[model samples]
Target: MLALPKPVKRAIAGPPVRRDGQQLDLDIQLLLRLLTPRRPQPVPPPEQMRAGQSFVDRVVAGPEEPGVRREDRTVPGAVADLRARLYVPPPGPDVVDGALLVYVHGGGFVAGDLDTHDELCATLAAESGARVLSVDYRLAPEHPFPAAVDDCLAAFAHVTAHPVEFGAAPGRIAVGGDSAGASLALTVARETSRDGADPAGRPVFCLAFFPVTALDGHTRSRELFGDGFLLTGEAIEAMAGWYVPEAMRDDPRLRIAEGDLSGMPPAYVATAGFDPLRDEGEHLVTRMREAGVPATLRRHPDLVHGFATSLGIGVRPRQAVAEAAGALRTAFALLGAT
Candidate 1:
């Protein structure tokens, strides 16, 4: 809805719901119930679906955060120059100056761009007091597989090399995003933190919001929440197919959870209890911790996938983001101290 629907307003104002040991946020439940069609409908072509993504973001995320300052520019990518947006939050005593988040936008690897996640970057910049650079990596089906991965790594390298050019400090660079973007961030972390990697140059922290850690796998969470949840299992597969071929589904880039996790930056992986990717995201935390990385996992039991972007819908989403921001602040402090 471009504006909050009456049903959504009612859901936001009502008490939350308890179901199956997980409390679904009332507003999220209402939105899912209202948006899901009564009968199956043909999935739109990629171009049409991309157009609808912009419209849906405006409707769900509302206006971008008011006080944040935005600048549009281009950043270096491995295969091509990519459009980018830099967000500088309003300065205040609480602001953690020079903290940088190389933010990636997620729309199942095929649909999202910087505009779809505009308010989200602003929210992260404002809440974390970090300068967030939103990357518009080449989408799949057009760019496919390693294009996204290569572009993100190249963007991260550019930001680290010229932090002041983007109004960020050199050592405070962090990588973060939601869903597919998060998957890319984790891959960056994995590559940058390999054995013999320079500790001082690697990402100091990573933030993942309900990351799709595995493209092929069946889990209880997927079976339970695959349908009628904000992100369906079928939808996940369709989007992933655009990014990866059937034979390459076993590649570490797509099946990220099974990859080696040693030497990763301190990480925060948040999962929504009612999300199909919940189990995989949680599994990422265990894998990271087992690898001796200082990683933390926060499960928002009341939320679902995509809640991180709906700042206009309810408070829970913002709260979850705020927590992630706090983690960034702490990581920045540690990085600065070193």
Candidate 2:
């Protein structure tokens, strides 16, 4: 094996030590602290406008670091147009042959958009040597279940079919997102496989960041992390109710863990320690492996949900994004080579 550089060696060695014996990684901790509420905000009523507003606020204001170019564009498709924010990394000319990461921003199918996920998308592109296409897919209550899923699938297909238009390698594509977006990525991957066109040669891999895999509302984390953790059970359940209609609550497309993982691509799943969806994410990882799909699950024991979106501000949250980014790059590297 080739010798790694000093920084890379150190990064591999793990995070720095603290005097209190509570050592934490710099990048991983970034999002954790940023997402941690400043002062406890009372849980908003389920499916209420105020709750949705609060959800958007946390995501948008979490991380706005310096140095990442952002651009907005209208992604034209057959049914509806999708709003997208493209995150172009700083000039690293050597990092050519960039792949396209069609990202669906997480908002529980209710709130959240390009602005909320700006930092993480840019950070991923810059760190992973890929172009991040953050899709502002339609939200819920106004849009609902299959609405966001349809938009995500359309946006991904549109981008993959016309890679040159987005300055990406036609055969190199990946899908990812945090929370609701992550769940959608899983759905789209399955749908793409069924069709078999794979304009970009199948999504190379999926980054399921704290994804809500099973929406039956029976996981233990939901009760354990119901209160103090950044995302309360009440918030997640409400978000689920808004994103998915009463009729399709049990649909495997939205509730990924219940679906067949038979031919899905390799996945790198991140689970927040104090998150209600943690068990679901872990379950998906286990199922992926059981179904012969390569997968790895990383649980941030001290972190809460939505950590990756806060990459630039907090200690643990930033570290979480960085860690996820590194995993993304490595996995995609293998996919690209294959």
Candidate 3:
């Protein structure tokens, strides 16, 4: 059964035809079900959530079968040595030839880590023909705003500075993440561009997956999907408050889209139809294009935020990963030509 919001229902009432040839609307529909709040069915401890996610990773993500080779490793980044995992496809030669994608996991700046995104990274490595480095940045509510940002920046710097150490071609490196992680990717791109001190004096392309670009809580999507969409306004507010301080919300390094986007690298932005951060992601895309930065925006109307990250479990998860891989491939090709 597909759980849909009133607005989403109304939007799809007239048409049985799928826009992107997707027959089933599992992404958004199931998300609505998950968001519906079912009277708190046996709430468990926070550690249990991690345990459950680990179980999901084991079962759904499973052991590497034939074509994939995964490993856990760490690199020293913005913060103290950050934890990271590397996913490389089989065949040693292809590892060096493939593009490198450094990923940050999304937990709204609070939860999530490399374990949570294990399957997604594997899928990306396989689909995009790119080695994926999943970063476990320091979470918020403990680390706070600049801590997360600094951690991510450090990860980016470490990767971009020493691509060969990670078995990557420095010229073909890209940064991306989901939700808060996505925002970090955008910010890193901005900060990196501002410095104009690249290893070879080239900017890094970015892939932002349903990123929460704005923290001001002023967007329409924020209000619409605030509640009953798996992510409520209160939840977002709490996460924002936990991750960022009121005084530094306007800081360009913290808020990537808040500042000028000129000279930023080419970007591919994804937005979900019913996500609170939908418009913020789109707005950034518009701003990037307006600033003459090569940009591409794609909206999965029948999807919600976090769909890409959760796709490893459901049928639609693979599709979401494929979409992101396609975006990465496209961005790499675009950047390669220039």
Q: The CA-based lDDT of model 1 is what?
A: 0.84
**Top candidate, metric TM-score:** 1
- lDDT string, candidate 2, 87-135, tens digits: 7776675243767788888767777778767767877887777778988
User: Could you tally the backbone clashes for each prediction?
Assistant: 0, 19, 4
Which one wins on lDDT? 1
lDDT of 1 by residue, 92-131 (tens): 8868878889998888888899888999899888888888
Estimate the TM-score for candidate 3: 0.83
* Model 1 error, position 59 (Å): 0.7
Instruction: Name the lDDT value of residue 21 in candidate 1.
Output: 96
Model 3, residue 303: distance off in Å is: 0.7
lDDT of 3 by residue, 1-338 (tens): 23455556646433332433333354345445444555744433335544654554454453443587777888876647988998886775434364788888887777788877887788788777778899888877778878887888777777777788777876788888888889887887887776545644243678888888777758877876665556567767767777787888777776566667888888888887767888888988988998889988988766666776665434555676688788787666666677
Please estimate how well model 2 matches the true structure, expressed as its whole-model Cα lDDT: 0.72
Query: After superposition on all CA atoms, what RMSD does each candidate show versus the true structure?
Result: 2.6, 7.3, 5.2
Q: How many backbone clashes does candidate 1 have?
A: 0
What is each predicted model's overall lDDT from 0 to 1? 0.84, 0.72, 0.72
